[model samples]
Target: MKKWLQFLVLITSITSTSALLASGGIGEGSEGRSSQMPPVMNAKWKAECSGCHMLYHPGLLPERSWKAVMAGLDKHFGESAGLDAATRDEITSFLVLNSADKSANRRSSRINQSIPTNSTPLRVSETRYFISKHDEISASTFKRKSVGSSANCIACHRGAEKGDFSESQVRIPR
Candidate 1:
């Protein structure tokens, strides 16, 4: 009986530690192991979101931000992106389930931590994390025809769509 009790305590400790780490934190000490956000696929999300714009990985934003985006799809970033009720709900579920706050990736966690709890930014560009990383690049640089805009991560990050934004691979086009 005592041995079983000890085993139970050990299991509980492991579970608690994993949960805390997975919740994401600035001090996660990911040691480069979690820098890449894992690719998550949902057929509906891919088809519906990528038809007009870049396919943003769900891990880029927190759950609240995604919920707000989904709720306001009719006026999505100045364009109508309305969908059938069922499609909307499925995409919303996919996004919320894989949002930054729910991710274990170090970069995703950093992005999640940078956001204030009271704010739900629709654009990832509005996040403090994104601003800090791109602060060195001038507005004109993003406005360049080759770059299009800051939202066009693919302009510099060739692997942006694949969740591989390693600095080593970045190449800003002139």
Candidate 2:
């Protein structure tokens, strides 16, 4: 009985260690390792998107959606926001490189999954996720100093550009 118990304990420990390694064990595995993590925002994206809209994070939309949005910027949110062909290509590439398709969340991978493909509104706000997250804010809240626009995610979500949206970082302006 004692020998059997010892064997079982050893096997459990080895199995657990192997599982951790297989599942991208933080410092112990190579899966999560990177040469250097990319910054959340850069000069290019900031310069382009920040002109009329807030510098929204590119990771918010899936690659397909970003491409779709970029392709039809003339009709973007019912406005003539088209970029020049060269600028459009640059922005589109950047967006696709950091899109939700590469995110760990399976739901985020399917960003437009629940919406009809033919939907006219290609804006991020039209997504179900955005609606649920922003529902608590009143209509007049946008007038507040904290929120400049719906695209101004950094106002409510500190370090959002770096992919950090922890509640502790939230600082609502008075």
lDDT of each: 0.88, 0.66
lDDT by residue for model 2 (1-174), tens:
999999999999999988875543333224432311235655667887878765666656777788888988899878888778988898888887877656544334435454455653356667776687668877677567668766676777776666544445667665
In model 1, residue pairs whose N, Cα or C atoms come closer than 3 Å (at least 3 residues apart or on different chains), thus clashing, are none
**What TM-score does each of the candidates earn?**
0.81, 0.61
Q: Which ten residues in a row have the lowest lDDT in candidate 1?
A: 21-30
TM-score, candidate number 1: 0.81
Q: Taking the tens digit of each residue's C-alpha lDDT, what string does model 1 give over 1-174?
A: 999999999999999888866644334255855777888999999999999888899989999999999999999989999999999999999999999999888778989999999999889999999999899999999999998888889889898887767777799999
* CA-only RMSD, every prediction: 11.0, 7.3
User: Which candidate wins on TM-score?
Assistant: 1
In angstroms, give how far residue 26 of model 2 lies from its true place. Answer: 14
